[model samples]
Target: MRKSHAFLLYLALSGLCFCGLLAHGLFKKQADVEHLEAKCRLARTLQLTDMCLFTEASYTRHLSQADLHTAFQDYPMSLDHFPSGAIVPPPEIVRRTNGKVD
Candidate 1:
């Protein structure tokens, strides 16, 4: 009836909706895990490499194949030209080996 009570009710409903969406995603993904695993296995069987994440730059296209200096090619402190550079981090192998592929 009151403004404060209405606001509280709205907050409660929104929170419930958020929780419901999260639960739906969790369950749906769990159900799809088997299908995803099968696809992964098929990809491995075909020797398929990782999917391209960003089409802007060669380094951004396939992170695993990118060398360390490609990102800083312009200069040491040069800002990234591709927006995806900020979004996708260097792969773990690149970080562990400091960009040495072997």
Candidate 2:
């Protein structure tokens, strides 16, 4: 019942809980594969784009589809209006092209 022992016990329990969650998710994902595949097929048929990551600004919501300037729509020196803009880096295409559209 010492402080160190108590902290060690808490860490052990947290590790066990983390492993249990990972195992559960692995099995659950296996069971849901068919359903997920069906959803993906439907999306393909509907010509859906990549899944939305952030729901703040349009640029943050769909980074892949957003133009580089969308983040600076207000002005050239305008700060990002959405926190997600700071969190998510510009898309690979924008980075590769250096913000130049093809």
Candidate 3:
């Protein structure tokens, strides 16, 4: 009986710890949502208010863009595909945000 009681107590503590970490993660994710919301709003000004543009997929894609840029920057073959004088642009805030560039 005592062993079972101790096991129950351990389970309770483990559950509480898991809940605490979940809450922390959700709170941190809110900032990511807000950042993406702001970027989406900017895109909206450019008439890019498509449903996907404001969705989580777009946010995650943008988040990964910088990483992709970094990975490709080191590869000489990547730039060789584009024109010699053409400069690769920075990672976009979101897709289609550069549609109006001169």
C-alpha TM-score for every candidate:
0.62, 0.69, 0.35
TM-score of 3: 0.35
Q: Write the per-residue lDDT of candidate 1 for residues 27-86, one digit (tens) a residue.
A: 999999999999899889988666855888888787778776876879999988889888
Candidate 3 residue spans exceeding 4 A from truth: 49-102
TM-score of 2: 0.69
Task: Report the C-alpha lDDT of model 2 over 1-102, residue by residue, as the tens digit.
Answer: 899999999999999999999999999999999999998998899887767668878887777888868868899999888888888888887787874654
lDDT of 3 by residue, 1-102 (tens): 699999999999999999999999999898699898887888888765333332223322343343334424546466423342133344455235545553
- Ordered by TM-score, highest first, the candidates read 2, 1, 3
RMSD of 2: 3.7
Distance from true location, Cα of 33 in model 3, Å: 4.7
Cα error, candidate 2, residue 51 (Å): 1.0
Q: What lDDT would each prediction earn against the true structure?
A: 0.85, 0.85, 0.56
Report the Cα lDDT for residue 50, model 3: 35
